[model samples]
Target: MIHPTVVSMVAAIRRRANEYMLRQLSDLGLEGLGPSHAGILGRLFQNGDMAMAEIAAAIRRDKSTVTTLVRKLEALGYVSRRKAPGDARKTLISLTPKGRALRPAYERISRELTELALEGFSSEERKALMGLLGRVRANLSLR
Candidate 1:
């Protein structure tokens, strides 16, 4: 039997993970939001209010994509955008009460994902796997 390529394996894993998260989100009554929106919301949920550019960077998305995601989040009553306190050119994105309320579900989803991904792995093995994946990511990030 032919072994699967690393890229294919990783892509498949990501697709499955995103699908699982989307299903969980739908079950929680958040029907319209996708992984991109989750990325932005997750960042704001963890870091509080952040500038648009910062959100884009943190989510590893382009500014235009982040703009669209932020708009969707705003429409869903999960986030709000305002001009930065000192910089009119910069906009800050923050979570609303509705968004904050999703924290418990998000935390549950995160824990579930972690447990699913690391199933049957010992602590040391999981750490090593993460370290190896980090190196792989770093390798691909080189210019």
Candidate 2:
């Protein structure tokens, strides 16, 4: 049977996955970026512009952390922040053309990461794995 430490296994996987992602990004000449930025960029790519709070919620990060990530992306010219047209208080974040250009590479990396993570899994096994992981995530998010 498998070990009883699911949390430890999950943490180890996350660390290794982030390390793999950082290596890939470094090879692509994205030196300063980290896996944390992926959540923001991916959300923007899928949902278009979003406010800071929305981004934080989407990424499951706190507002302050999201702000810092956004600032780094802004400095790198991957994203831009502007005031919401309707409410000047809300800052809307959107991808620059440079950010959009990363779509293909990130897509490939995401696919390759999944493939590596599920190297031995069959289609049904992959589906079951995803379902289980989703439930795990839900359980954690309920805290």
Candidate 3:
């Protein structure tokens, strides 16, 4: 029997990585959030404020998923959503004071995840792996 295909291996890695992030989130008292929330939070942290469609594009998720995630974050007081001043049809999401304060913890968790995933790899190996994975991702992109 085959050990496993590349797609299966990558998927397994993602599942395990998500579990690791969830456990880290739990330890940090971020109970209601999970791995899915990280992309939204991290993007907001980097880009300041962004519209729903912008967040969806940045995170590679659909607008509906971004809407749900932003709504949950707003309900939790981690983010605030409001209509854009110039465009009534566009809504922007920004981090609240509570969300802004999560930077340190978020960085720590992200760093730990990287360390855990590449614990045995040399710097060159890590770089090569990233390049290969990036190529694979690009290959699968539809647009």
Candidate 4:
């Protein structure tokens, strides 16, 4: 059973974690991106191509915001958008080679940031924290 206090504390911690992570990313030359944009990029990097609406749903954002972000990425040459061959009204989005090239750098910076955040945590503690985070995500996803 989850206590209300525990839930509240967890939520606060999550916010703090987000702030800290974003600050670290800022140090790594990550700029001009809000949380939503970062979320979209991460999703695209992990899941490959997707429809605009699908990307919006996956990122828990609205379609208009996703469209703007997609346009920005497209202009930056990081992504490309095309009408799906079978469906003219539906657009498919995919990361370009330049975007794929960013994966290694992003991964490295993220790993370094995570390591810094967990500097004092033991290996077992880090594993336990990761497992708990995964379970929390799974629980939220089911809803």
Candidate 5:
């Protein structure tokens, strides 16, 4: 059985990481983009333009939630919706110029996060930690 101390520590660490990342994102003019928005933006950055359903599946969020996020992003001029050429009923979501400009700041914040998370770890230890995390993720996926 998992120890109570370990569970509490894990919860605390998760909360701290979330708060720190959100603050960093806000400092970069990414205000209003909470954890949900961050997940959408991250997916857009890596995968380029995608349909609303595609994004929802990629992020494992319900379509309604993603739609709300897309609406907010559209209002902020961070994303644009275009009618698919082949299918008029389908809309594709892509980032706008303003959104593209935020990529560098996003990357910097991610680097800062990595550095902070690994501050006390030796190079070997960091590598091992990363490997273990990847394995854990894979194991969970099998379930």
Candidate 6:
């Protein structure tokens, strides 16, 4: 039996995951909330308020992309920005009440996404897969 190519399989999985997340978000009436936005939201949910540059770094996105994402979130009433204390040049981002209200749905979506991605895998297999994926990511990160 021929083995599937790693790059192709990873790409396909990423595409499917993004599509699934988009559908889930749409079903929850969150139109226009894409994966990049989700990443920012997830970070804010876990880490509370953070500076714009910090959020960008945490989400592994560039400042320009984070700027756009933050603007969209702000427009949706999901997040707000404030000037950092003692640092006029720095802007901090935090979830508004409306955004905090999304925690339950986000948790549910996260659980569903994990189950969907790992369906039929035993606990040991899941652990192994996670380790292997982490190693692959580390390998790719090397210059």
C-alpha RMSD of each candidate structure in angstroms: 1.1, 1.8, 1.2, 4.1, 2.7, 1.5
- What TM-score does each of the candidates earn? 0.95, 0.93, 0.96, 0.66, 0.80, 0.94
Window of ten residues with lowest summed lDDT in model 1 = 33-42
Writing each residue's lDDT as its tens digit, candidate 2 over 18-125 gives 999999999999888899999999999999999999999888899999999999999999999999998999999999999999999889889999899999999999
User: Better model by lDDT, 1 or 5?
Assistant: 1
What TM-score would candidate 5 get against the native? 0.80
What local lDDT score does residue 41 receive in model 4, on the 0 to 100 scale?
A: 78
Runs off by more than 4 Å, candidate 4: 1-35, 131-143
| Residue 7 shift from truth in candidate 3, angstroms | 1.2
TM accuracy, model 4: 0.66
Q: How many residue-pair clashes does candidate 4 contain?
A: 0
Residues 7-76 of candidate 3: C-alpha lDDT, one tens digit per residue: 8999999999999999988988888998999999999999999999999999899999989999899999
Q: Best to worst by TM-score, what's the order?
A: 3, 1, 6, 2, 5, 4
Full-model lDDT for every candidate: 0.90, 0.94, 0.94, 0.80, 0.84, 0.92
* Candidate 3 lDDT score at position 118: 98
What total of clashing residue pairs does each candidate reach?
0, 0, 0, 0, 0, 0
Note the residue pairs that clash in candidate 2.
none
Q: Which clashing pairs does model 4 show?
A: none
Q: Give the per-residue lDDT digits (tens) of candidate 1, residues 1-101.
A: 99998889999999999999999888988888887677887898889999999998998999999998889889989899999888899999989999899
Worst 10 residues of 5 by lDDT: 2-11
Give per-residue CA lDDT, model 6, range 13-110, as digits (tens): 98998899899999999987887788899999999999999988987899999999999999999999999999999999999999999999888988
Query: What is the full ranking by lDDT, best candidate first?
Result: 2, 3, 6, 1, 5, 4
Candidate 3 off by > 4 Å: none
Point out where model 1 deviates above 4 Å. Answer: none
Candidate number with the higher TM-score (3 or 6)? 3
TM-score: which candidate is best?
Answer: 3
Clashes of 1: 0
